[model samples]
Target: MEITFLGTGAATALPLPFCNCPLCCKARTSGGKDIRKRSSMAVNDDLLVDLGPDTASAAYLYGFPLEQVQYCLQTHSHSDHFDPAHLITRLPEYASAGVVPMKVCGSSLTLKHMSEGVFREDEGTDMLSPEGMQKLSIQIHQAFPYSTFSAGRYRITTLPCGHDPGDGSMVYCIQDGNSTLLYATDTTSFSQEIWDFLISYEFHFTAVVMDHTYGSGINGEGHLNQDQFIEQLRIMRKNGIAGEQTLVFATHISHEGNSTHSDMEREHAAHGYAPAYDGLSIRI
Candidate 1:
């Protein structure tokens, strides 16, 4: 199995537009891995996690075969993670005839937001055309904690996390035979119930992707900093959820963080945490 990071930055991305921050300034001049887009990932070529606003741009820039995606696994309804406007581009007018109806799997609240954005059409105003909704095809599958479902060749199990209490959020455990990966984002520490559920699994994860919205800072109730990330790793290892062979990654980066790409890689090398940049692909 292969994983492709479509975008690996926080909500505002690495460089905020029209800002003269040190990081953004350097990013403009030094355009390599320092540049980042919104957070999103693709599993193999069929499953996508989060349909962010940058999904279209990332697909074009990185040559991601998004047309092959059959399932969209949403973490939350945050604007950066869920962009229904961009998703409509897959309608019959824009996509090919072979494009199948995308099966979007997420929490009830997340699916509600998607439905409202996709199906809600105001014929009274010419702002959003009804043709897109009329021609588009999608199947919404509501996901809950501990519930497992199959999409294509992948089996997914949803784990509840501490992100949003009102709408709720999830972390996904994806598996295809022996290959297993945990895609955890848009959430902070794992909840007690989630931890209990996770520990029951027999095998260690092949790769564990974490949320790093804030770097070396206090917990923001919804995101994880570097300190929290490390602690979480320790706990996972102690609980047998991760082993030395497991590949660990930190993504959802922000320019406001304490370190740059190179700096973070150096600082976290001892802990075996690799910072994820846009377009990075890993085969597990």
Candidate 2:
């Protein structure tokens, strides 16, 4: 299985549009990996994990085959992670000739919001009818926590996350053949119930992309810092969900985190953690 990180920064991105903080300034001056877009990833060119506002530009820049993505898994309703406006372009009129419909799975709220957006224009007028969406050939599935679903060669299970108090968030564990990947982001430490659910599963993950909204310090709830992330990884190890061979990566970074890519790599190398950058690709 191959995983491609389309974007790695948090909602504000690495260099906030109008900020002059040290990290932001450095990212602005130093190009390359220092620059990042909103968080999103594609697996094996078939499954997309998020549809951030930057998806289109990032896909063009990184040469992502957006037409090949068959499934889009939304973690939550957060604007940074779910961008319905961009997804509307997938309609047959705007997409490449003969592009297939993309199956999208998320919580009920997420799907509802996306459907509402696709059916109406920004001004709230009726833009597209059900027949139009049918012609466009889009499918929306509501995913339930702890339930399993299949998308292509992947068997996916959803885990509730500690983000958003109302409906919470969904974290995905996708297994294809011999390899498994845990995509966990926009979340803080797991709850005991979620921890138990994870421990019940015996498969080891090939790679895990964790939440890193806060780099080294805890700025708020519903997000993990570097220290908290390591602690959670330790628990996963104890539960046999991860081991020495599991490739660990951190994403959804903020500019205010105050750590550069090289600095985070050096600091986290001992723990087998790598700070993910936009366009980073891994094969498992």
| TM-score computed on alpha carbons, candidate 2 | 0.93
Report, for every candidate in turn, its global Cα lDDT versus the true structure: 0.82, 0.81
Clashing pairs in 2: none
* 1-284: candidate 1 lDDT, tens digit per residue: 89999999988887888879888898888877888899999888788999998987898787778887889899987888988677766665555477666778898877666666655532222212344333555666789878999988899999888788666688899999979999999788877777787887664799999998887865566888989899899988999999988999998888766467888889888888899889999898
Against the true structure, what is each candidate's TM-score? Answer: 0.92, 0.93
What tens digits encode model 2's per-residue C-alpha lDDT throughout 161-236?
8787465478899999889999998888989998888777675888989988886765767888888888989998
In candidate 2 the C-alpha lDDT for residue 98 amounts to: 72
Give the distance in Å from residue 17's predicted Cα in candidate 1 to where it truly belongs. Answer: 0.8
